[model samples]
Target: MTTNRTVQTAADAALWLAVHRGWHVLPLNYGTKRPLGGCVGCRADNKPDHTPQTCPCLARGDGALCHAVWAATTDPEVIRRWAQRWHTSVWAVHLGVSGLLAVDLDTRPDPPPHQPLNGLPWPADEPPPADGLDTYATLAALSGGTVGTDTFTTDTPSGGLHLLYEAEALRWKGSHGKPRPGDDTVRTGLGWQIDIKAYGGYVVLPGSTSKAGLYRRSSTTTTPRPLDPWLADALTRTGHDRTAAPDARPAAPVPVLDAQTGPARYAASALRSACAELAEMEPDTGRNRKLFRSTTRLAGMALAGWIDRTTVETALAEAARHAGLPAAEIRYVLASGFGRPLAVPDIRSAA
Candidate 1:
């Protein structure tokens, strides 16, 4: 009887639902958050330091997962084909890449006696996941409506829940566009483990399998509520630790767009525009590829002498901060997008 619930069927259903909503969808690796790596032949083809962007596999006929995120599309038939080929593949939906939001409410952090807390990597000092109930209650009251109660929700594999909402744009200021690995600290309304998967973010979609179990959707509230003004403001408020540290690391900086002349300044303006566009993109599947294309365009502009190297770096830094994806991943994404190696400091300034 259980074979009826094959991973392929669940993933296909998810793709179909996402496409119906105009949301781009992509396949993820089973029991893991990352996408499945390309087939063995593609891996062997990669040079010692070759990254995803430069991988010729993506351009080849068999490059199925070579460029995972870029393959996200709204075409129903294409989605069906992918579902058919990648049977065990789980599905993920990129949030904020398209400006959509997923408020993750985990099962209360109350771990069972002698049993670990459900698998979420929340900080040690945070409140139990059950408190999310209270947090949502608070938000719903602040919004002055019952919309929260009826909003779209999903059951995560770990026995937690995902509340789906639409945002005007990616809201939280966390991640400095450089979210780090093992870092699920992306902000949302106040509460422990209250996660905001938006703006260059993603979450495993419903109807997928994981080590925890199946990611199943519950009875959903169809209408998406707009970001309430109060709730929006609350989400932007981060605690002290979550704030940017004063440091020598690459920080989000205002690009050198003040000047009205010079090739570098013109490049800065163009790059800034690209950054802004990237920032406003709703989080959706294919976001990694979307990031690649957007960042690649910026890199190309710099190489083409349209913007200064420093300005390009600054633009990327700021955009990465806005994206809130892990900084390490950004490194790979940039490399993959460039089709070649890129060292921030090595980029030469234009004359």
Candidate 2:
């Protein structure tokens, strides 16, 4: 088993090293993708969040990391203290927070059975042309650029790809970016499988470790180039145009509810709970991406007879708008979620 001390030491080194090179770092809890918490008094009783604290004492001593992204910093001391406090942490740079962006590409021929890629662009029966799924080659074709230059790249343990590029600005332009179901931020001309991590987002730093496994710097080149504008265009454009959804839907797990009330009803109740959860997230700050993941699971419940399609759409549309999503964005996001396979917990199982 990994001990906190050993993990913390590695984390401290990686974060400081990144900061030394001018990258802002947020130390997330090891094996998870979120930052450490503030004192108990300030945290949500159930879920974790990244919000600053109001208490003068804590605020004066250390900025509350309750809002994970807000705590992003280049300050060496603060990072060191955080690492020491949560020894089993890993590094996740605040993308677009420090003039950095990442191009995440999915290279897997087929998504792992357990981790389906929801909302694919093609119909379930008609998969992408064998060539369409080639991440690196397609990137070059769409972006009019090559990944051959001396740029920093990380070979993700999940068999995915991560390439680091220098952005001209500190963050992705908020006015131009809209979230897609894959947590990809797109412009009008971006392409499929190319996830743009810009402002209001985070990606594991190249040297980080996670439950997924260690992320290794696979390429020798350390210098990065400005992201190719064509690539940006493709990331934006492709995200908007795709209409096909996934065919990953499967029968939901049977709910283990009291027989008197019926197990199916329990399943329906669970779906409603999920719908409420997604609809409550703030869309202006990464809501659409999360909506895709949540809805994918909820869609399974609907197919399982726990909820109706109309009810799901109505509840989702209302919530999407509340999160500041526009109509087109909402529709695309919903369709993507519907196409995805259900991946949420069983309501009866919760009991």
Candidate 3:
């Protein structure tokens, strides 16, 4: 029979939109269960002499407080307007994801000190998909061709690499500057770029470890260097072996939890740390470095190695805390407006 439980499912979906997709609505905490109810666990003395405590989910569970208007009208432009109206402030916006791959073994013996793992050739005019959900899947399908299938290892106790396909691609150029693709080359505003140093050890057999390096097409002016022989061999064994092409899929509208508890929370946290990294800034360029992108790449590395979001989030939070900043501040900026030059709190001061 149709019951209250059925209705709650739709309510839960609405809540997700509010948190992830910038829906302009409020969620009141009412329940004591995994999903929120009308101020869950809160009690009040609405007696002869006292007033009842206001419910967190006043209209949520009790009636129809959770509305659909939030998701229906939520958009970047609208969110910007809401921020201005509500005086909402954010720290930074983060974009893109990076992953690990099997390097051609022949080149691993003496890989370049810093080179892209592989060349990703995506069109410059590729528009971002509608929502976070679609963006990841679309990019994954496109990147799967280039990154291919592989196992990645991380510092987690498992020591086993996570099987990866593709990761998300986000941009906050309005708040943060964009990564200029192929500065000296013809490609600009293109999709599929990499950080030269985000590489971890390359994948080999059960016990062997290999350093990382970038590869280039023979047609490109760059040198074809070897980083790991096994990776290189793997590349040769696979077709194309050097470059990846874009798989253009429209990003889907998948509502997820807030950055604090979402799948991409780790990436968001790492973007903040990367942007604030002292060493990442280029003395000459002043602010042309791709540190955030590199760090996001590292998150991809974790994802590639099958590091769970919880693990990545924990490690990145620890790193940011050690670096001295509120963990949530970074995420707010990326989800909202990136590179907007925010005044984040000093973590050291909290101590």
Candidate 4:
């Protein structure tokens, strides 16, 4: 297999990932992680009712590449056609289709807002983790395994890491931060800022360039190593393993209904409607904007004591996940919504 270090253009990188790495590749928007605009028939304005699963273009497999990740292909001809049709500076490898998994350790601000242990008890001997990398190192130490830096690795545009590993026979589910219903703590993946990328997830191919900077190979190893047993165990414990049906989506949390009257009922109804709309959002559409809008509304309600903040976050996260937004984007949208100030309903009037 040709080393990714030699690949220059996004097209070449896509080809290399498909042909050499045996991975399904797809084109992303130039200098951005977002997907390219859909074809005429599949555009949001043209067919607002259609989703990736229901799109006729995808069903026909006419190689339209309309649904982004769903259109990922190992076919060299399709990739070449995409390269010609779209100006792609970045591309992604579909991990599920490629039978691979990645541990994404994101860089966090100094004195990170969330703790790496999440809600779990931390080791008394170890100091607090400063970032995802540190959290991962702590997990490795606890699991009796060293961090697998020698395997295939890429340095993200941000000062973070992507550790690629072969997922041999294990069908795993991807997770962002652990946003469980009724759990208010800001927990993420196995630890804070750590994410698991598996089925229904993708990682940017090495050599892909984005607005922040270039994603380049950080390790000399050309191939991904088989997942370490300890790491695999960690993934299973953290809810990455798919034990039941493969197509099953995580059940969305039921919004808290402390009271059936007044603003409480209104807030619950609003939460359900917002989540449903979010779940129905199509790929490459205004998903981010919709998420921001929905979350802002819910955050205001939570602040007004009409709803639980954790429930709102959990519902939104799951709904956005179902809508196919990436984990990182979901987190960002949630944070933005929570931080923004919005008008709250007049509880006295409703009462």
Top candidate (TM-score): 4
By TM-score, the better pick of 2 and 3 is 2
Q: What is the Cα root-mean-square deviation between model 4 and the actual structure?
A: 12.8
Better of 1 and 2 by TM-score: 2
| Local distance difference test, each candidate | 0.56, 0.58, 0.28, 0.77
User: lDDT tens string, model 4, 155-184?
Assistant: 998899999999953398887653444333
TM-score of each: 0.49, 0.52, 0.16, 0.62
Best by lDDT: 4
lDDT of 3 by residue, 284-320 (tens): 4422223234335545535444234444343333333
| Candidate rank order under lDDT | 4, 2, 1, 3
Position 327, candidate 3: lDDT: 35
Ranking by TM-score: 4, 2, 1, 3
For model 4, which pairs clash?
Answer: none
Better of 1 and 3 by lDDT: 1
Candidate number with the higher lDDT (1 or 2): 2
The regions of model 2 sitting more than 4 angstroms off are: 3-9, 39-63, 108-133, 170-189, 235-351
How many residue pairs of model 2 clash at the backbone?
19
